[model samples]
Target: MKTAIVGAGAMGQLFGARLQLAGTDVVFLDTNQATIDVLNARGVTLQTESRTEHTPARAARASELDETFDLFIIFTKGFHTQAAVASIAHLIGAESCGLTLQNGLGNAERLQEYFGPSKTLLGVTDFPADLSAPGMVSSNSRGKVRLGALGNVPRLPNIAQLLDSADLHAAVEQDIRIPVWEKVAFNAALNTLSAVTGLTVGGIGADPHARGLVASVLEETLAVAGRLQIDVSRQRIEAALDNAFAHHTHHKTSMLMDREAGRPTEIDTIGGAVVRLGQDNGVSTPVLATLCELVRTAARPGDNR
Candidate 1:
């Protein structure tokens, strides 16, 4: 399949390199001239815990795209979702599909708005990815992408098959809402804490005060999820949070990375979304509510967080 990776940041480079290594015709789409120049010149380097692999790559700006593609996988940050997709919507052919493995809520909705349910796929990756440098990316995504169709659209076997052929470890979920919420809740719980406290994942897990605050956020989010009947389990979110805290103690969350870079974190999409759902569901999310304000306040003015 001819695939284009929108938002070829860390995760983009990781997936793009792997797909190309596996023999798929993959190209990158990014707004950064440096990223495009680096990719077009020497391709990308993907580093893992074990070893590294280099893959030849191609890239172009969205406006420079002159052809349609079979698939577009969005890895852009939450705030850039709308504009990113809109800029590249011309590349999505009639039979083509768009998949978003992005973090936070509303991404699926955004993709659906642009591509429609029948042409949209929702996916989530557990792979921890970091863009160590402009042309270098690292990830733990050794296998498997959890994917599902949106709304009542019939499962597209071709999408999963193509990813599997590229050795991306594709697995289809009948109802992907479960994993979506699970991941969102996990991010909502700890990412904000890491950003606000200036601590690593492990530090948040170790601190009694931080852990207590995280637990409150989790409870409030789960309550809201339950009310929405999203099939999110408290036990599941707790287990995932515990697992991350224990294993990735020193790891910095995406939110913390954004905060440090003075970029807009997905604070509203992750934490603020929880608070909004809580209010709509008649559930009080005081902890999440406070987190939303604090995080927003902490964002620098020039960044438009």
Candidate 2:
């Protein structure tokens, strides 16, 4: 299949490289000129604990994609989702599948707004990767992604087959919204804390105060989920937290990487989403609200304080 991976950041490059290495024809669509140039010239390079491989795939700015794709994977930052969709809409044929493995909520809805709801496939991944440079990615671990049609799409089997063909384990889920929220809740607990504190997952769990902060965030998130009738529990949230700390003990979250790179963080998508829900439901989320404020303040261009 002729696949196009939009966003072409760390996660996009990582997955694109993997599919290309597996002999699938894939290209990366990104807005960053330098990164696109490097990718088109040198190909996508990735180093994982198990192996290192570089695939010579095409790369182009989002505007340069003139050919239709069988699969168009959306991996852009949440804030950039709308723009990416607008730019790539021409390349999305009716037969193409739009899969969003982005980090937080609202992305699926945004995608559905552009492509028909039937063409949208929402999914989540726990793959941990860091983009160390243009055309280079460090995939610290191999993780699986769960994908499902958002609203009765007919391409579930085809999408699953493609993933299986590429040796990726993607399961069909009828009720994926729950797990998406679960993952979002889990990320809300740790990602913002790690970003604000500049600490690793293990580092946060090791500190008494940091651990307490994460627990507080999780508690508020669970309360919000309860109001939304999602059947989320503190036990489930804590268990996921424990698993994250155990598997990616020393990893820094994407939020922290954004902070380090002087890029805008996904505070709006993760923590900020929680804050909005709290306000809508009249639920109190002082801890999450405060954290969101601090992160936004830091991400501001001129605030330079």
Candidate 3:
């Protein structure tokens, strides 16, 4: 399969590199000229805990891309979804499948807007990675992705096999929206708190006050999910939080990384989405609202205070 991964960020590079090593023809579409130049010139060095491999890469901007792609894997930030798709819409072929392996909610809708509802596969991943340098990426821990067609799509299996070839465990899910909600709820609790407080996941997990804050936001999310008849539980999400404290204590979430990089976060997609859903469903989300406000304020550009 000829695959195009948008957004040459950590996850994008990681997926592209692994897919390339697995002998899939992988190319990246990014607006960043510097990253494109580096990828096309030196390729990438992919390092995991157990092994390291050199993977050749190809990249092009939307304007430079002249070939059709079979698979379009979106790894861009949630906020950039629309622009990213617009940039490369011309590359999507009649038989093409679009997959979003990004964080947070509404990705399916964004992808479907351009790629068609049935042709879009929405998924989530926890494969933690960092772009060490221009052409260097490191996957800190092993993780797989769960993908499900937004509607009855025939090419779903083909998309899954494409990732399977790359050794990326892209499991097909019958009901993916629930998991997407659960993951976003988890992020609303952990990512927002860590981003606002400048604390590691462990720091927030260990603090009683922070735990209360997490509970508040989580309960609100659960309430919203319940109203929609989604089978998400406070117990399930809370247990995941406890497990995260134990296993991912040292890990910084994507939101925290964005803050450190001075990049805008997907607070709107996670926390902000929670609050919006609550309002839409007539459920109140005071905790998420406050956290969203604080995060947006902190992320404002050129703020000296």
Query: What is every candidate's alpha-carbon RMSD to the true fold?
Result: 1.5, 2.4, 2.1
lDDT for each residue of candidate 3 in 44-159, tens digit (9 for 90 to 100): 99888988889778888988868888889999888899889988888888888888888888877888888887788888887877887988998844688787876898988887
lDDT of all the models against the reference? 0.86, 0.82, 0.86
lDDT of 3: 0.86
lDDT of 1 by residue, 178-292 (tens): 8898888899988888888889999998999999999998888888888888888788888888988898888898888888889989987888888887888899999888887
Model 2 lDDT, residue 47, Cα: 87
Q: Which stretches of candidate 2 lie over 4 Å from their true place?
A: 246-249, 303-305
lDDT of 2: 0.82
Worst 10 residues of 1 by lDDT: 149-158
TM per candidate: 0.95, 0.91, 0.94
